[model samples]
Target: MALLGIIRRWHLRDQIPIREIARRLDISRNTVRRYLRSETTEPSYAERRSVSGLDKYSVQLSGWLKAETTKPRKQRRNLKQIHEDLKELGYAGSYDRVAAFARQWKAGQTEWVNSASKRTH
Candidate 1:
């Protein structure tokens, strides 16, 4: 967005050359042109990237997470513990992979709860 703003200010306000804008912004001339012509602040992105690294054990991981939600926070399994358990079950991914998926799942759960509460109230 900031880059787009810079391109717009330079092109529209100062009548700067696209090549000059590209050079100043360290971007391609085509990129400068596209940003100038774009109507929105954000770039459009594809939704729902196909994730497969944790797909093999996602169900088991979800089950563990759901079960943990009923337990006290102190007693709940941490990411490292969960990663270790998945490893024992033949998961060949890194700890970072497990942690990242766990975070995404937890965030989705939070949003679900928030929307449910909003609808009920």
Candidate 2:
């Protein structure tokens, strides 16, 4: 959006040539022209459907997080520790994924945090 704004400003306000705009912006002339012609803020992207390395571990992680709520803050395991535990349990995801999961879990909403409300098989 910001890039598109600059492109629009340079083209509509300053009346700069497209090639010059592309040169100054260090982007392709085609890209600058595409944005200049486009009416939308940005081109839409499809949602990613790939399975996460963490997907397999989600249930286990959710259980651990649920159990942690009973512990005092000082006694509760941190994101890194939870991530490390996931690692031991064959979780192939990155620490960021685990940390994100931990944050949502701690919030008591979204993702695995809502698992308690879900009907189990």
Candidate 3:
């Protein structure tokens, strides 16, 4: 958005040529022209859709995490141990992927608990 503003200001206010703007900004002249021609203040980009290798094993991992919450703190499996367990099940992704999923899952659980507590109060 800032780049778009700079491109507009340079061309409309300062009357800088498209070729010069492209050279100064190290961008394509066509890109500068497109920004200037567009009426919208912000450029729109296609939404990104990314799939993780862990997607296949997410349900199984979630089940294990939920079960662990019921166990005594000392006996519960930590993330490393859970990663090892997933490896035994043929999950090829890195431990970091598992850890990230766990963090997201824990966050969702925390939000649910907080919301439920708020309703009761």
Worst 10 residues of 2 by lDDT: 108-117
The C-alpha lDDT values of all candidates are 0.88, 0.86, 0.94
Clashing residue pairs, backbone N/CA/C < 3 A, model 2: none
Candidate order by TM-score, decreasing, is 3, 1, 2
Question: Model 2 Cα displacement at 102 (Å)?
Answer: 1.9
lDDT of 2 by residue, 1-121 (tens): 7899999999999999999999999999999989988878766789887878888898999899878878999999987898988888887779998888777766765555468657573
For residue 108, what is the lDDT in candidate 1? 98
**TM-scores of all candidate predictions against the true structure:** 0.64, 0.50, 0.67
- Model 2: lDDT to the true structure: 0.86
Per-residue C-alpha lDDT of model 1 across residues 1-121, encoded as one tens digit per residue: 7788778888889999999988987889998888877788866668977867689899999999889999998999888999999889998899998888888999999999999999998
RMSD of each: 5.0, 7.5, 5.0
Order the candidates by lDDT, highest first — what do you get?
Answer: 3, 1, 2
Lowest summed lDDT across 10 adjacent residues in model 1 is found at 42-51
lDDT of 2 at 7: 96
For model 3, how does the per-residue alpha-carbon lDDT over 43-120 read when each residue is reduced to its tens digit?
578999699989989999999999999999999999999999889999899999999999999999999999999999
Whose lDDT is greatest here?
A: 3
Winner on lDDT (1 vs 2): 1
- List ranges where model 1 is wrong by over 4 Å: 1-51
CA shift at 93, candidate 3, in angstroms?
0.7
